[model samples]
Target: MITAIRRMFSSTIGKFLALAFVVLVGVAFALSDVTGNSTFGGIGGANVAKVGSEEIGLGELRDRVRLAYNQARQDQPTLTMAAFVESGGLDRVLDQLIEGMAFEQLATDMGLGVSKRLIDGRIADIPAFAGVSGSFDQTRFQSFLRENGLTEAQLRRDLRQQLLLEQLAGPIASMPRLATGMAQPYAALLLEQRRGQAAFIPASPFAPATDPGDAALQTHLSQNRGKFTIPERRVIQYALFDAASAPVPAVTDAEIARVYKDNASQFAASETRRFAQVIAPDQAAANALAAKVRGGTALAAAAQAAGLAPSMSGELTLSSYAATTSDAAAKTAFAAKRGDVIGPFQTGLGWVVARVEDITARPARSLADATPEIRAELAKNKANEAIVDYYNTIQDAVNSGASIEEIAADRKLALATTPPLLASGRAPGQPGYSLSPELAPLVSQAFQGAAEGEGQLATLVENEKFAIYAVKNIIAAAPPPFAQIRPDLLADWRLAQGQKIARDKARAIAKAVEGGQSLGAAVAAAGPNIGSVQTIGGRRGELGQDGQPVPPEVALLFSMAQNSVKTLEIPGNRGWLVIALADVQRPDPKSIEPARVAAIAQPLAPAFGNELVEQLAAEAKRRIGVTINKKLVDQLRQELTGNAPVAE
Candidate 1:
């Protein structure tokens, strides 16, 4: 729960803006070419690439990459910076940056422009700029800019560039319409069917007869060390305490009396009103709806009959309701008595006709009547403060060289130790082990800290609970001793040998079938251990009863040309299968209905638009030449991965 709350909190206003900013920059941000120039060596310095006259600075590249990495980490908690860089994430971000700049340059040269008013509207629409009243606040917007190290001018410039790019590409990439005549062939392809013969060669049947010996097992283990290696683990010592264990301050009657006196405005009488209303496009419709309601027809029924829906507004004070609707509507609704039908007044939404459904009135409370509530509130506040004080005392003890056990003894709390576990809190070699809920959050933090028993404190449940913890031991990730996994290694080696043999046999069968031999005869010739050839068939668009995808082998058969024979390895080293296509049947285009063609064409329209936009981007890049600084790019990658040598 703590981890989940942290993730939720980490998605801040800046992250929200980054998400929307990427969309404004380009639609193909994630789809940027990962296979771009990777040999980083060039004369360019500081800048990653030069798009026309504009340079994409290395700083921008680094910031974008870091932002993207952080955003990606929200979904993938275990994703490491090195792994993200190695997985083409850096390359893709650079490509997107280059492409966005290139397109902006091209659009500018073409005289496309975005107005300041347009940029203002875009900024105002972002919910992050809204104040507590849920309206866009200029102060909030300016503070966000200051926090993100951005000026208003820079924000507008970015917004302008994005809007210009959208104008340049929007029409071409917008909803495209494909004709039925053009879509029939694709529809027919989906209806195409194939029948094939497949024979399974089980790997277990081909296991080696002799023992591979300990030496061979050791060699295999050395070659495949990564597969057997464990991640770094830590033994953690922690002590926990909750609000229930903390002392609450006593509340006196005088204190409660003082609170009521100092905060007398809170005890003032208040009124809230709820209303049922229907908005119409025009005043005539509004008048008619009101008349119908007054004629004893239910407001919901009357509105629905007129092709509208009636909605109930939540109970709100007069000023709040005025802010939500319009002052005129609020005044009319609030003036009427309970169950009164009123309003043919104009609101911000439209012309409104409303019924006063309910009114809730709260009378001022006396000191004695409010005493219980005030006392409870005071007690809760005092308890929270006590918990925080307790937490600080424990933290101070930890900082003063007290071990978790020593601190627990001083505080009179229980001290618990976790088994050596990974950052995810799973004990190595103990799959079923789980940390108690209170201790689970500490493991992640402990793994992030030094393993020298440096004490730290974490608020596990905010003021309600907290834990003090330290890493007791560090277990470096490595492969276990040879004797520890010898049996497992031997079994894996046998499986590997069997898979290799099965693969060879499958290839032989495929070769024989391709060389003008019957699939059944080829399998029979291979050995009696091979499963009998089974006929497999599927339509290209076939789905299982549960709507699952067609099996991979069947899909492969449909993709193959007639008379083609191929071998497919089953997942998990289960076996290999030799597949031979016997026949393919494609439905006649004329047999496909126009409706079917339309259905196929609808989804393809967007794909067609995307292809057109891709072509447009290529042309833009050609016009506004892109030059990559290969050396600096390579340096960036090395820096990100910590592979760069330390300076002397």
Candidate 2:
């Protein structure tokens, strides 16, 4: 119970949100003396919650707490420790607490046991555990464990169980099968030697005729009413609480000097190095070159004698490796240390030799000088405590059936309008408004929510400051009147005519070229007004071509025959193209298999996670059942820092 509470309460929100679950631990945690460092069921600290003889340890609890803390920091950077504590970082802390104990308990009950060998193998697989020599480094492994507050043995045992629990959930998906016969056209892999002639008669050159009537216009409107409805949109004025706006207290001069002295090494410029390299075929050959380097021969002279490229002595930063940077041939350059004759490091290009001439360290920033800025930053973070409350009030007003204007007035928020929206998800009258970053998604969600008038207010969301929206008015979609749409219809009709005329001309050119007329001759015969023909290379997707990937209809266009002459007639858009297959290159089977496998695995990947969640939930219910402690959850929700009121 104590472990669960600790895990639940860790958050960045101010108090009342977390509701201080810690105040309710019941003194049982204090009296119990076992700290769960080694137990397989342990969390981070002393076991406050126990299932049978198994206890959730302080170490595991701490790990989960740290992970949650880091995540909170990332998700809500302005969160101050005080706000976090108040917002009931404690409740989130508690959620994690309950979740961890529950999952651990469920895994135990299922008789799932992880093996030591598997744990060892997994640890060995980590790149961090490898030494500079590229072998498993026991010293580094031990150091890493110590720093993270874990004993290697304890970590191994827990990791084993965790992996086993995860694996037991099983794979939840299968590969996407390429539909039968879909690859038939693509399999042709045509490489045609084409000598073709074509002319592009720009339809824009001629004025299109227009004679319209209400009857025709109404027909057009009836067919395309999707173009005129007003979108359901809301605008809200939000408060911003920024950390940069906060004032940091000044640091004392003495403190600043002390901080600088303490971190003097940081102020030093890094070492500058000079080295010459000898590219050898393998590590053994590289090692031989290192011996030569050490045996009093100049690195460049030695390389020349060894029948390798004699790279002249050059200066480099300690971190720079030419082989690892721009020059692949100089990759063996990993040998530079203070006054040390280093290397014959093996790289893609071969072996290298280096000598360090000097170490220049960088300057350090003192804590005293930075304290005021830090404190000001802290103050701004604290100031943000009220923003989430604002989102909450706005949401509360909407949930209680307030009108858009009423909600906006109550919260003193803005009510913004969008460009005239269409039923097909477009803003017909505004530039880029049809596909704007924020407005588009916002409009779509507003329509998807609970029916028109009793506006659905979204969670207080913000790119920076907290934001919430109340649907002002939901427009029920209907076709527009024909009188208002005739002009558009005529414009579209004329373009279609022009494309037909242009295509006929292009076909004649293709046929003439086949009959031995020069491309220039065919184009001249088609019309003097024809524009230059353009050739491009592209693959098709739902968006017509990869570059135009958008609508499902367009993607179909890309799948058509490589060189087949096709006319694409989109409503309001007319285009024609003559495809001449230049080449079709199939990817190498072995090289592309891995990429395909990964692509297939991506969507299937999340199923395992979902399965695990469900499995644990089921197991947990079967074992101990759920008791929401609704009061606690509610209290925690009330105090959430980043988004308190919205959750309500």
lDDT of each: 0.73, 0.45
Summarize candidate 2's per-residue lDDT along 1-648 as a digit string, tens digits: 122333333321111112111211211111111255532222234343453345544334333433343334333423333345565555555544454445555666778777677777867766545533345767556544443344555555445544644544433212234332333222222211222222345554442576556666556544443343232233322222222323334445565556556656554444445554456777776677668778887666776676777553456653565535334323333343554566655455655555544555434445655556555655455445344344445545655666766665554556565544443345544556544344433443343333345544332233233334444444433333445655666775566567666667667766765566655666677766565654444332112334643542233223445334433333333433333333334443334344444443454434444544555545664575544435434433343322344321
What are the root-mean-square deviations of the candidates from the true structure over C-alphas? 8.8, 20.1
Record all residue pairs in model 1 with backbone atoms less than 3 Å apart, i.e. clashing.
40-630, 40-631, 41-630, 41-631
Clashing residue pair totals per candidate (backbone < 3 A): 4, 70
Each candidate structure's TM-score, on Cα atoms with residue i matched to residue i, is 0.63, 0.33
* Residue runs of model 2 more than 4 Å from their true location after superposition: 1-198, 201-386, 389-450, 455-464, 476-486, 500-648
Residues 295-385, candidate 1: write the lDDT tens digits. 9999999999999999888888989988977787677777899889987888767988888889999999999889989999999878867
lDDT of 2: 0.45
